[model samples]
Target: MIYTVTLNPSIDYVVYPDEPIQLGQLNRISKHHKYPGGKGINVSRILSELAIESTALGFVGGFTGDFLKQQLQDRAVSTAFVEVEEDTRINVKIKGESETEINGAGPHITPEKQAELVSKFRQLKQGDIVVLAGSKPSGLPGDFYQQLIRLITEKGASFIIDTTGDELMQSLEHQPFLIKPNRDELEELYETVIDSKEAVVQYGRDLLNKGARHVIVSMGKDGAMLFTHEGIYHGSAKPGRLVNSVGAGDSMVAGFTGTFEQTKDIKEAFRYSLACGSATAFSEDLAVKEDIEKVLQTITIKQWEE
Candidate 1:
């Protein structure tokens, strides 16, 4: 079984206008839709599209929380959320001539609630995969994921994390199953400009040396690269117009995890992950199984001769 953790989730309200807006003039919304928004939630949704079953674990509360869980349930995704004291927040995304967004600061997570989440995670059996995804809510300790990584890895369950900065660097000591960082994130981690592919592979290998079993560097349209003990593999993205870049990385993580869980082949997982990410990038929403499949045929993975 695979489990995904969303420390902070939100109801993403997307609105669209048919015409241009004028300063000091009111604009009317032509269309609007709401979707469950969070890095972990996106992963679970993608996994479901691939016909994989996984549990979503997080803290949700109030009417917005209810809506998030219902949205997941409607898509046939199972959720195990801790009810909290405050309502879950809403994120508003406006799409007109240009895309605009206003994100929310979700409700505070109490220590007691945090501990309960930890307890829930303790039940995972060996060989189960848990994805500790997204940013932490306010008031949580900086080492929150560090602690979770330690706990889950100690219990014999491998974990994947999608975060950067000190939090990610700290968790490396626990040896996460995988870490997916973008080009900018890589620069942030190493605090230097990566001027060439050699430097990219070198810094990535440095993370592997720091105890990360595998590291995936997402390079947008240029494609993504996978680094592991076996060897380095690169997957070039299929040509497509970018409809939405949101959730692309999460989709990549889900695709890699889902395929690896079933096939345990790093190469196959690398190919599938690029397809999943490109599929999402080519669509307004997270990629469906069909979209991912179409992109898979165009995926080409090459060995990096470093």
Candidate 2:
């Protein structure tokens, strides 16, 4: 089984403005839409699109949480979220001449609630994959993710972590099943400018040497590269107009992890990863199964030689 953890989830409210807005003045929007918003939740939703069953685990509360939960349930995605006292957050995205975002702080998770979420991990067994994504809610210990990694590793299950900065650096020692870092995040991790493909391969190998079992460096329109112990592979899909950027990375992570688990074929997984990401990029929202299939037809993966 695959489990995705989203510690802080939200209802993403996207509003479209009829015209340019003036500061400090009343503005009106032509339309708006709401969707369950969280990195891990996005993965589970993408996995469902691939016909793979996954259970979403995280913290949720109040009416906003209810709306988020219902949204997932309606998509046939299972969730095992811990309820909290305060209501879950609502993130507002205003789309005018430019996009602007206002994110919420989310609910605080008490110790008891934290322990409850940990206990759920105890049930994980070998062959299960746990995807830990996004940031945790406030009030939890900084080592919360580390603790969960220990439990997951002890149970013999593999894990994938998609985060940035120190949290990402810290997880390498446990040897996560996979880690997907975009070009910018990769540069930020090593604190160096990567101006060439050679630099990318060098730094990607550095991540492998640091203990990541598998690493994928996503470079937007430039395509993505996969680094494994055996060799490196590069993948790309036919170019398409970019409609949305949100959730594209999570979709890639889900595509690679889910397909790899089932087929154990790195090339196939990389192909699906590119297709899923491109499909999402070409859609107003996350890609559906049909969209993925359409994009898959344009995907190409080749072994990369240095």
Candidate 3:
């Protein structure tokens, strides 16, 4: 079974306006909708669209938490998470000429509540893939990913981590099975801006040297690069217009891990990942199986010789 962890989840309330807004005038919302959102939640949603079953883990509380779980259950995705004291937060996304996001601080997980998560993870055995996705909530320790990686590794189950900045930097020592960092994240890690494909691939190898088993540097629209001890592989994105870039990288991670869990072929998995990402980029929401398959047929994989 595949498992995904979303330490902090939120209900994304998206508001769209029909007309331009005046500086001092009150703008009326023409349409608004709420969706279950979070990096891990998006990953699980994509996995479900692919006909793969996955269990979502994390801390949820109050009515919003109940709604989030109901949304997931409505989509046919299973979840096993602990409850906390505070209510889950809601993020307001105002879409107009430009998108504006107001994110909220979620519930705090006490040490005992956090321990319950660890105990739940301990039940996984070999062949089960665990994905620790997204950032830690406020009041949680910084080394949270590091701790989960160690725990899953100790249980003999391979793990995939998708986070950037310090959360990713601190977990490198655990040597996760895979780590997906986008181009900006790659630049941040090396403290240098990458201008060419060669520089991106080179820096990807640098992460492997730092103890990451496999490093995937995702370049939106340009595609993604996969670096391992074996060699460097490049997958091209299918030609498509970008409707929404949100969760595209997370979908790539989900597609790669989801396919890898079945095929275990790095290159094939990357191709599927590219398609999944591009598919999501071409839509306003995460891609479904048909959406992903359409692009999968056109995605081309090229091997770069060092």
* Greater-lDDT candidate between 1 and 3: 1
lDDT of 2 by residue, 23-93 (tens): 79899887999989999999999999999999999999999999989999999899899999899999998
What order do candidates take by TM-score, descending? 2, 1, 3
- Model 3 lowest lDDT segment of ten: 17-26
* Steric clash pairs (candidate 3): none
Name the lDDT of candidate 1.
Answer: 0.90
| Candidate 1 residue spans exceeding 4 A from truth | 21-25
Q: What's the CA RMSD of model 2 in angstroms?
A: 0.9
Superposed model 2: Cα runs more than 4 Å off: none
Report clash pairs, candidate 1: none
Q: Name the lDDT value of residue 53 in candidate 1.
A: 89
What's the alpha carbon RMSD for model 1?
1.2
**Residue 198 displacement (Å), model 2:** 0.7
Prediction 1 TM-score vs. true? 0.97
lDDT (Cα, tens digit) per residue for candidate 1, span 1-306: 999999999999998877765659888887889999999999999999988888999899999999999999988889999989899989999887788889989999999999999899789889999998998889888888877877897789999999889888888888899999999999999899987778889999999999999999998877888999989888887689999999999999999999899899989988888999999999988998899999999999999995
lDDT of 1 at 160: 95
Error of 2 at 160 (Å): 0.5
Task: After the best TM-score superposition of candidate 1, give how far the Cα of residue 138 lies from its true spot, in angstroms.
Answer: 0.8
Best by TM-score: 2
